[model samples]
Target chain A: MIKQILNDIDQNQAEIIAGLRKLIEMESSDGKATKAQEFVLKELKEMGFMTECFREDERSSSQVDYSPNRF
Target chain B: MNEVHLKWIIPPTDFEYHPEAYNVAGTIKGKGTVPSLMLFSHIDTEAENYFGKFENPYQSTIHDGKIIGLGASDDKGGVAMMLYAVKTLLKYVPQLPYDLCVMSILGKHGGGFGTLSALMKGYTGENSIYLHPAETGHGFAEIKNISLGVVDLDISVKGKPGKLHDDLSEGVNAAVLISYLVTYLEKYNQQMRDKNRFDFGSFKGEPSFILNVGTIEAKGGYGGINQRAKCCVRIRFYKPLTIEGVVEDLSKYLKECCEKEGKVNFADVIIERGSFRATPAQVETEDPFVQLIEKKITDVTGIHQFIHQYHGGSDIRLPMLYGKSHCVGIGPACALPQQNSGQMEWISIDDYINGVKILASILFEYCNFDQK
Candidate 1:
């Protein structure tokens, strides 16, 4: 049973690698990390995992930019 | 078939260094009579510019066999590895007895606010693995224990009113006195180093006790200068030492000095801040868990386990200090340059896979063993 699961993971290796690559490409910095984080949330949701995105202030969408100085 | 409920904890943005901070969480429920285990990693990294090494440090690159990026090693890699490990475990051991959780929390570097927040929200379990990069090298490196403590002290002295003159003895200089105190502290640090040179396998240094003056101030003009001056000092103590002992000893010495020289006066001292110490455990290297990991590594890479000590701090303290859980950090080695630039970092893909395998095996072993 474990071997079968390992085979399944191996078969999906490409997708997994692609997901990691996509996450890395998002360029998520400290304060300006929202867009990238949103991307991750979308990916998680697509992967059949329940996901939610929370804003620190809930009122300002622009404040999510990953910039240490702005925070 | 038991369905595992996985919840991703998205922490409030107000709690992060960036206006937008989050905690990513996923859970898998345990099978009959199995204990729950959490695998955690931090989603934050120290600013690239702190060490002034890279331009556009956030951009990740792949060169040779390495994944070069700001968090490729420090933690992002650990996060990725944990995610994959869970995926593999779920696929392979579908009905395992243990529950598993993976969290990429925020604010791990800035005093672990992310993990603390998660704990505050009541996310906990019996066993946990914090996926911070192992401090380089190969073999079985488990941080089963830690010495967590804080040092608090203020070094200050007063000088009589005076002006700059050729006769250096005429004016009592607070600045000079503070400078002397700084020198004494430096000497004390040297003494500590000489006494506790790094030995003990895998553990660094003989657990240090130190005094550092992070701030200084003085009152009254000296050397033809205007305005009264004062100084504030910061001290850090190593394991096996307490803040009370440090303060008491320093106070005693100060009193003795004042008695010898009636001119100098001691001011009120306070423990501006304090942090609790995480006690080290006496876990053996050949324990079942350790042996399990060793066998897994040998199976995968054909290399005997190499054990070493960590001379730094990490979120491992959270579970050890708060939850009393047996925790260890295992991950791929990061290729950090001699002088780190947030940009010039990397991890080997092969090592990353080995790390995942090792983590999965450890989890499986724990699941099979009953924690009474």
Candidate 2:
């Protein structure tokens, strides 16, 4: 089973690299992964996966803050 | 003298957080067979321009069979592998037996809040693997079962404008004062390195703890002497050293140093613990989930998977700390800074594809999907 899976992945290697390029070039270092995520959202949506967006705000997802210390 | 007249130092915070990052999760529903699994990677990249500036950090330049860009190896490669591995799984076996969650969170070197948000939003699984390529340069051959604790410290010394002074007890040069503190810190760091040294694993023969002075800042232009100077020190320590425990020991050490200096009060030297402030974590290497992945790695790459207890902080610690999930980290091959110059961060193309292949196999078994 694993061997077959590996073979199939070998075939998709080109597409995988392409997608990776698109993601890397989009630039998300500033924490606003808007462009890169748009690509992700599109890809997942096409795959029939359940997708959701969560952003940092005062109201949502702030209850447990495992924050990094910074200046 | 350039000795500083004591002002005050702000103590360190427990940790830090980001405000504008995003956490995106895509899930393929499972058949309620067994506990669900998650493959996670961070999206955000850091400008770790330690050696030199990474020109066009996001350009996605490919050279000599490797892709060079910021986050290329650290996680972007992992993200790509996870994303495509899921695609391969669904293409080969659509009816997955268990849930598979793929997450791309803002796990910047800034820390784990992006992941914390997802867990809080209830997007976690019982078994989680963070896919971040090894900086150990061992490529996909090693697995991270251990994560180091971190405490980022900000040491600031108040500056006072002044001309040249030869022990005249006049204006305070913050830079000079900080230089003095650096000597103490260096001596102390050497002591730290001597204890808890490692004999095996990825960082063999090196100290389990590392205190690196990453950055120092003061006014740059003219008349800048009066401005406050600050130094950012990062400490990555191994187990048996809790963040608070390290903090207590370090605070005491600094207090003692300052009092002995006498020219500066410990109050005048503020060392703030800014980031990470996390504890070391270990997921059993013998965990069934990890065993399954390791077996798949060997089957896919034909390399004996060496489990490396990373002496550094990672998001794998996130799930263990917050969600109590078992964790392991696997990824492709990438070079570390100072090893790969100009284009500091990059991933090997062939290794990355194989990483995807290995992950695909893991997901198939993880989802209870049978051979077609």
Candidate 3:
């Protein structure tokens, strides 16, 4: 039974690989202020998942950026 | 049919620097008797420069049975394997005994904001598998756990000006004086190394206490021009070495050195410290999860698995430290420790499939059969 299941997963591997390729093609970079977040949001929503977004406030941002002008 | 519900979290801009970073979570509810387990992997990858050779570093390519691409081995591979495992369990054995939560969080490389934010939103589970490279070929071995900590410090010193000509005793040269301090620290480092002082998993030696004099400045002199000198020092310490203890010891020695020189107006020495330690963890090599993974590998390719430790940090620390859960890292071997440079990085397709199978079997054994 486990072997059959493993085989089934193997059969579906191509689609999984394709999805991953699509995700990487988006070229998301950190702190770039790009649309990658929007892309992720749309992708998840289209896949029938609920989504939420959060951001750090001024106080928290300042605390996180604690290094003296060189972080 | 059993269904897995995935929750996609996208935080607002006010919560993080990269506000677009997202966490995709899917859950398979348990049948009442088993424990809940979370499988986590990051969705983000390191930034690439414009001059990078790869046309599209993110696009996956298969050449010579290796999956070549940015994020292919680092984490995207792990994410795909995790998602597939959960999906497989849901389809083939819907009534898993244990509750399962699979998540692909953001920022595994440097920005831990995604996982940190998720934790803030009250996402908790008892056990987790953090998927990163396990460097296949050494058999199926688990990371057992991780030691995540930080070391931050500053070291500075001041000295007076020396004579312009041949007056050997006029004053101390700030630059030269700072060099002496660096030499002293280096000597201490060598002693630590010789004594086998610091050891973290596979990485060993006392110089675990690393010192980097990142900055130095000096001004002021005796006769006409003023003279002074200062240096910024960074110290990295292994676990059990508190930052405060290191700073205090260095400060005491530095002050004594200044006093011995009889330099009243010498440069000021300043040192600061910061650190974080993840709780230690261990999983028996014979545990069901470990055994299941080993069985899958042997069955698939007739190779025995070996257990190993990771020398660096990973997102494994997040769950191990905060969730207080059992966490292990598993994946395919790409570049050897010292061989592959940046562009040459790649992972065999066979290894990738084998890793997925190992993860899938472990999930079924732990989340399905173990409880029964």
Q: What is the TM-score of chain B alone in each candidate?
A: 0.75, 0.81, 0.72
From the highest TM-score down, the ranking of the candidates is 2, 1, 3
Question: Which digits, one per residue and each the tens of the lDDT, describe model 1 over residues B196-244?
Answer: 4434545555545445565676533343431234344444444344444
Error of 2 at B170 (Å): 3.8
Structural RMSD, model 3: 9.6
Assess the local accuracy of residue B24 in candidate 1 as a C-alpha lDDT between 0 and 100. Answer: 60
- The list of candidate 1 runs beyond 4 A from truth reads A1-21, A31-71, B1-16, B136-144, B152-171, B187-201, B204-207, B210-239, B243-264, B268-271, B274-287, B303-305, B337-343
Off by over 4 Å in 2: A57-71, B1-21, B47-62, B68-71, B158-167, B197-206, B216-229, B261-263, B305-307, B336-338, B368-372
Q: Mind giving the per-residue lDDT tens digits that candidate 3 earns over B1-372? A: 001111112222332345454565555567756667877676666565532556666566778877777666656667766766666656677677776666666653233455545555655466677776764334244443443333344445544445563244875555566666666666655554464344533344324545666766655444433344556555544445443445555555655655676543223444432222122234444555555556666776666645545433355555655565655666666653224444634566677677777777777666544522
Query: Against the true structure, whose lDDT is highest?
Result: 2
Using lDDT as the measure, name the better of candidate 1 and candidate 3: 3
TM-score of each: 0.73, 0.82, 0.72
Write the residue-wise lDDT of candidate 3 on A10-64 in tens digits.
Answer: 8977776665555556665443323444544454444333455553332221123
* TM-score of the second chain of model 1 compared to its true counterpart: 0.75
Q: What TM-score does candidate 1 reach?
A: 0.73
* Poorest stretch of ten by lDDT in candidate 1 chain B: B1-10
Candidate 2 lDDT over A1-71, as tens digits, reads 66777887787777888878888888676555767777777878888789988875432221233233310
The DockQ assigned to candidate 1 is 0.14
